[model samples]
Target: MAAGIQQQNAAEDIVIAGAGLAGLAVALGLHRKGVRSVVLESSPERRTSGFAFFTWTNAFRALDALGVGDKMRGRHLQLQGLRVMASSTGEIAREMDLRVNGKLGPHEVRCVQRNVLLQALEEELPPGTVRYSSKIVSIDDQDGAKILHLADDSTLRAKVLIGCDGINSVVAKWLGLAKPSESGRTATRGYARYPEGHGFEPKILQFVGEGFRAGLVPWSDTDVYWFFTWSPAPSPDANGKEDRSAAAMNQFVLTKMRGAKVGPEVLEAVERSEMSDVLAAPLRFRSPLSLLFASISKGNVCVAGDALHPTTPDLAQGACTALEDGVVLARCLGAGAERGFGHEEGEDRPCLGDAIVGAGDGEERERVVAALRRYAGMRRWRSAQVIAASYAVGFVQESDHTVVSFVRDKLLSGVLAKTLLMMPDYDCGKL
Candidate 1:
């Protein structure tokens, strides 16, 4: 509620909250379009917590548009397909081939460490683009600009505000968006490192157990990433507590995998993983109906990433869709600039300020809002499909009912390849 102050000073053209993958990608994409932005992160330094995750072809295409595709491909491990197996019998259930066929040639999926991707994006930006430890306290829209109140009592004003913060985004709340709901499942993940080498194939191996799921992917010759997910018993404390010691966490994971039909190599990899590398959290997602009906933008203020549509990990599309959001947003804003949204004719613009003034007239504000609306329209339907699919997959995979499990194990497995093939392919057109 920090309002009622109008200072006679120029403000940034764009202010993006949160320095996660989505935020950084937006900044990088904007830079590619001759725009500049300041990123605000609450953390004191770089975040180095999360493990590795899969990046599908659509994600690679987005990265390519951002001008980092080759760099990312060179630094990660590529795989051909995903192999699903039965945890009870260790028998193959389904195989999802991700390789591009015919004229497309070779399109490979890769798994890259979260920290590595973050570092890659941060390095691409100009120095001082991101301000660390600058948490947002509140936001106010006044006179065609967004005024952000920082935790340190300082303030920033921008012609446009983008919320790339994650699921627990403060920006989303200010925009009146609903909070994400828990998916009733918990997941634990970590990277296992072997000093020698792990002779595993370059395919993602998954095992579906009774009301539980496990997967492992070789990240490199000496490191492997693995995950285990399950639904805890319904109770007041079903979400579990945090602050557990590393030893306790490792023990818990070992206990969960006991008697499973997972191969010895996978078991050895888990045993070799350092206790500190393991992380556990409850899975959460936003329903497709809510996302499809929600207002993603108000005036020139909008959100991206999990802030807009947070889906479950069933399809591994959360980060991919977030990356797509960044590129699409940048394209829309860049097109608006070409149409003279903020700049005067024949102006030699050097930064975002030259393209859009913070305190513009009604005409300029309307143009900016129109551009944001275009971005929302382009993303809403596609994101809704991903959210719905992810939710359905999670429901089927984590169901405790015998009929649901039987259908999933018998009928669904046969159609997974077809379903995966039907997913839309994205290409963020020229910047």
Candidate 2:
């Protein structure tokens, strides 16, 4: 950890941690409102490991607010509905139309490559906005500002800090939040590429089996993203190295689905994936109740995205909700600035030059804190509901008990799928 020695310069208006989806989106949102923020990323460069994200209309609305919706929409494939099937027999269970409500114009569920989205967000920002390789080691809430200690032996002070780091966020730990709990399931995801183009319709194909679930979504004519989730089998050595070679993992996944009802196209997609691209990890989520009641921000230090509301991907709302957080948080801060809330005496915070007049230091700090609290208040219940729903969906889908499986297969699947499809679209107002 770097020492907490303060630098000679003045504090920044806002400093965001983790330049992933949430962090970069917030920065871009703030920029659109004429509020400047510094984004710090721990990684040496943009992440390429994440294969793809299933983005819905709500996420697209948030992106549109940040002014990158059309560009992002053009880079992916759109789907009208999902094909649910029985994993054991591979029989078509149901087809749930995604646009049943028709509330989001013509927008439908789409799958975007994660790196492509990140790059689009990065490109929208001014050059040099994101500082890579700048990992934070420690944070101290001093007086009315946050002092950050980076692993590179440097320090920075900001009036407000937003932690958009993922599940293992150092900033969340500093906020006294418990570590994320594993969901007792593991996920393996990869992208299947075809230079010759895959002749597949725009739809998501999902299969549910005992203690396992699998899905495939065509990202474009040439690329498709696939995922499998299953309860892990006990191993004598928990930390033992397993073969991660593409051929080995592909074989492992194929063997698991060998007698299942999956189609030949699904098998072919997995076989086409590069071994290095097939990544697996244990799924984890933060308790929604804890997230609802916990203090996400103390003074000017706060957290967002997975750092604030990590949940299972059963509902495919994790990324969508994170995008919502960025838009809402930026709007709150921008509203505060409009109300003369972020100014201070003799302090030069970017993007608030004209709004700094006539506010005392004490008054400014009070309003800034108020803005952060409002951000938390607005997000708390919304995030809790999504987290809880996602967890419940996962529980029912993954249960192998005879009674639970019967309820899921016969009753819950139809009702729950429709209810999920009818989930109201969210708009974060405007910046």
Candidate 3:
């Protein structure tokens, strides 16, 4: 450390990769904890084209803790219940009343465009805190400091590295965690505007048939978010993107259900959707660690969000869990600094502008690891339960066998439908 050279400031050195919901929520949470974080997004600019996201009461409480819930006003379309229809008859088979479920708290879950929420989070961060177009190449936790190697050949070191970089996270792979498992089916998502001549009440509607299923989640009077998942799937298109050919996918589904009973309106809506509006993806998830990592901080590194738990959207718990991670991590840091846990042994901690600083090789390493393990331990089981339930939901919806489908449609739907409505405390957002 020489005179006139700027030193690192731990308060300003927390770098979060990927500016998706998980990354931004963590930044917002860190701000509330009096910890400054610099968010690094690889995208050239902010995105506004994301589809709809639903927020349960528990997630709302978590957002409230980050101080941004007020912006959600007028964005929520309260769900009254979930509706399941018979694939062969198009008759309502079951409904889960949400009114009774409201007893846990305000049951009015909010739905908003994902981009709007991202903007809200961006606005809450300190000006100039996020750096866009700065992509990460490699992260090396060696010689004490956790060093981030950028594609541009620059470097960043910090007391800890929280990997919110998402499913393909380079950081998690560097830590030797196994890659996420690809669920055999492909999932396509899109929004359909309520064009003229259309009339349907707001509801959470799902239709199931052999080899495929579709879900319609209403977000407002103007739009409906829908997705379809199918098995024995086609390979990814040339660009490796999900099969976004809406006309093709929908046509495949319509053929599979031809002469099968379903509402004409639902069928019409699917047929009319054009190719340009759909987004597609192959679903994936990490193998659950029987024990939360003994240390997320291996030496000077840590991971969060998708890097740690890439959940299936079947649960719709992805963003909620990430938001919780952001807040909890920030809470630990802000709280840790107060207990004098920010510095490495022997050497002073690195400041923002200095060469990377390490969290030390022995006692300091154990302490940081212990903190992260605690954080992971607190979060892992809850996440595992949600993932399990989500898989079961998918199984019930995608079953094709006549006997199994009949039993599921007639007997299981009634019970499972109601359970989803009342599963309180599912979102650990309060932390």
Candidate 4:
């Protein structure tokens, strides 16, 4: 190989695609491990469009490991419990207490704003770690290096490539993984602000009706995050595109729940949502069974977060699992480098970058490949379980059948609540 070629590849040791929560968290974790990595983001700036998500105990554990747990926890109120209500009767159908931690200790759950979360992760990264507007149009595996073709007509060569892009990931497709299928549902999410102070207890308040579901979580004293999901997903508009007009989606939420027996606060929350705060999407997930044979990783390239396992939001574990993915992937890669390559510093552990200098070597390449395989091996089953459970929970809770509703609302509500609480009781291990 030419000296210039080797130098170019040396400067690109580890490169991660997409700067979302998963991508940024991976970068942050690698930094903590003393491994440097560059993140590529297609957007012109940091994307803050995901709105917010419920941060369960498992997510907080990963956040703590990423060094932002205290910062995030300090910003949002810990939700006390979950309130399930019948949208028709305006009466609380069930109350699931979340105060007890079981084995995880003082149960921790909070509704975290996506913008703030992204900001926190970015702050932890070294300056210029993320290259925005640097989109990867295509990828090719050449020899031991991954050749990334960017949209700007530039190219990058990396010893290791981690794809943390979202559901419709280019990286996932290149790896020959099956495309995600729709869940026959659509969700509209938004936040409402009350400068004067919105008075609501710190509880995840949810309402359900035939073929529809909605929920609200107080984000802070002056803000609340809410969402509406419905079955028989909406059709594309004249342009043959999912209509994302904030006005349309906002009005749709109000019209769908006009006659429902939900509280006035619920109605007002949706009504107060500004166009800027609203976001809409058709729900989609990669079948868990397909994951059984999915190419989560190939050679030194791998996928993480939604790129690897796009699960339904029924369990509210989407973000949490992504957080878990970041830590696990970092640990696997960092450890693999140390174990496979001898550190030159006598007894001290070498940085992943330093360990993989001659990454083109057969033995060095094998080390990176093994690291990715370990990541896939560790996360594949765990992710499949979470995906399947989310689907099952959604199937039962959203079922319109009279008998199923009876079983869900009465016979097994408590059991379901306990089960849901226990779903996120995982530890991502120390970073």
Model 4 per-residue lDDT tens digits across residues 1-431: 00112122334778899899899989998877767788889888888787789999999999999999999989999999899987756677789878786675777899998889999998998877888887888987665577888876778887788999889898899898889998988888999999999999999998876667899999799999998888876667898876768998988788778867777788899999999888888888998988988889988788999998898888899999999999999898778655653222333665445335353455666788888899999999988898898888777766767888777777777776877887788888878
Candidate 3, after superposition: displacement of residue 6 in Å?
16
Against the true structure, candidate 4 has what lDDT? 0.83
Judged by whole-model lDDT over C-alpha atoms, candidate 3 comes out at 0.65
Q: Which stretches of candidate 4 lie over 4 Å from their true place?
A: 1-11, 235-243, 340-360
Model 1 / residue 271 / CA error / Å: 1.5
Query: Candidate 1's error at 255, in angstroms?
Result: 1.7
Clashes of each: 0, 2, 6, 0
In TM-score terms, which candidate is top?
Answer: 4
TM-score (all chains, Cα) for each model: 0.90, 0.91, 0.84, 0.92
lDDT of 2 by residue, 224-310 (tens): 999988776424235696555566667777877776777888888898888888987778988888876788887777889999988
Return the clash pairs for model 1, or none: none
lDDT of 3 by residue, 1-431 (tens): 01111233223356777788778887777666555677777776776655776676666767777887777645757666667777766787777655454555645565667887888999988777677766778866545556677665666665567777888987777777677888777777777777552355656777775656777776777677777776757655788854546666766656655656666656655666666766667777776652244244454456777777776666566667777777777666655444444432233543233233442335444555565666666776765666566666676777777887888878887666654655444445443
Tens digit of per-residue lDDT, candidate 1, span 145-252 = 787887777778878899988899988888888788988787778888877887888889887756777888987888899987777622343466453455665666
Q: Please list the residue runs of candidate 1 whose C-alpha ends up more than 4 Å from where it truly belongs after superposition.
A: 1-10, 100-106, 233-245, 341-347, 350-360
User: In candidate 2, where is summed lDDT lowest over 10 consecutive residues?
Assistant: 350-359
Runs of candidate 2 with Cα error greater than 4 angstroms are: 1-10, 102-107, 233-248, 341-360
The model with the greater TM-score, 1 or 3, is 1
The lDDT per prediction is 0.77, 0.79, 0.65, 0.83
